[model samples]
Every structure is written in C-alpha cells, then in structure tokens.
Target: MVLVFLMVNAYRELTPIVISGRTIPLKTIRKAVFIFCFALTLILISIFLILFNQGNESSFLKVLFEVTSAFGTVGLTTGIAPHLSTFAGLVIILIMFIGRVGPLTMMVSFGFRKTRAIPQYPEEDIAVG
Candidate 1:
C-alpha cells in the first residue's frame, strides 16, 4: 500500500518535468514530491505503532528500535533483526529499496521522457570566496 502510494506519487511528480519543454512547473513537481515523502514517513510511523500494539509482548522502545532500523534500511537493530517474520522481512526489504532509490529514480525509470540536449549559453566567470 505504501509502496504503491510512493510509486504513483513519484510518477506524478517526475513525469511532466522537462528542461527543454515547459509542460509542468518544476516547483509543482518539487512540492508534490515533498508532500508525498512526508506522507510516506507518517504512514511508516503509523505502521510502527500498529505493529507495536499487536506485538505488545515487546517493549515499546524495542519495537521502535526495530521498526526504525527496518524502515531506515540500516540493517541494525537491538538483536531483533533475526526474529522478524518472513512477511515482515519482505516489507523491510521493500521499504529499504524505496528509501535507497527514492521516489525520483523510481519515477524516472518509467514516467520520464527523453530528448536530445539543447545548446545553452556558455559559462561566465563569477567571483568565488
């Protein structure tokens, strides 16, 4: 569910962007991606809360520790990484991929349009500190 949301939102953000062709505003794409990533973080937090509630035998801190480690794709945890269920591990893997590649690359693979480069003005010197 979260993966799907991320994929779709990323597509929406990156699809219409073109440097040579002015189709959609770049600012619009940036804002949408920002909001989508924010929402994804919130969704992951909500999932963590639910998992902790269901696995009440574990301490809240432990649950948070494991969840954070999993979602961050850090592969680090308080000795709980080996204990996760197969389904949970798969979720972690998917989340890790998403976190690593991010929404931009995901969208670029499918939604982007390719075109030949256009010539641009030559660079001018500017003072540097």
Candidate 2:
C-alpha cells in the first residue's frame, strides 16, 4: 500500500496535471519520499542498535526481517519479538504506527502545513572541504 502510494504520487508528479488554467505542483511527492527515507533509515539504525545492545543472539537477517515487518505493518515475525526488550517493543509500535498512518500523514497531522508563499533568500557559496 505504501509502495502503491509512492508510485501513484511519482506518476502524478511526472505527468503534469493542469486544472483551471493552473498546473498543480505535487510537492508532497518529494516531501513524502524524503520523510519515508529518513524515517526508514532512522528506524532501521535505531532498531539494529537496540537489538545489538540487547544481545539477542539473533542474526542480522532476523532483525532486519522483524524491523521490515513492523515497518510494513505485516504482523509477521521471526519468533524473536517475544524476547525483545520493552524499549524495542515500543520502537516496533512506533514503526507500526508510522507504517499504518504513513510518515507524510503523520507529519501533516502533527501541524506540518505548507505555506502558500515561500520566501526566497539570496544564495551565497561558502568554503567547503
């Protein structure tokens, strides 16, 4: 379902949609992708670290499966969830909520609003390593 939403958003972004003499910009697509990737990375890393600290003795594959399952809200497990720590369980719940509601929807519900007018600032290049 998430993938379907992403694909649909991407298609809408690629194909221009004009209504009432104005082209509608699908800016949510970029925001959604960024939010999804950022959340996925953060969740994966945090879960991996938590599992590592718990000394579960489970292989990386099993941990990955559990995290992905939670993120996808698939309710599938590798029998390791029962042994996980409380903190890990909370993290799984967070991921499950994020998966079910979607990162974009969660952000929007949390008062993330898009402004009609964006203020542009002058660009300046700074020294970089």
Judging by lDDT against the true structure, name the best candidate. Answer: 2
Q: Give candidate 2's error at residue 102 in angstroms.
A: 1.3
User: In model 1, how large is the Cα lDDT of residue 42?
Assistant: 44
In Å, residue 62's CA in model 2 sits off its true spot by 0.9
**For all candidates, what are the clash counts?**
0, 0
Model 1, runs deviating above 4 Å: 1-39, 42-54, 57-60, 107-129
Task: Give each model a TM-score.
Answer: 0.44, 0.62
Candidate 1: tens digits of C-alpha lDDT, residues 63-108: 5666656556677877755676666556556666765776556666
Measured on C-alpha atoms, candidate 1 has an lDDT of 0.60
Scanning candidate 2 in windows of ten residues, the lowest lDDT window is: 1-10
> Considering every candidate listed, which one attains the maximal TM-score?
2
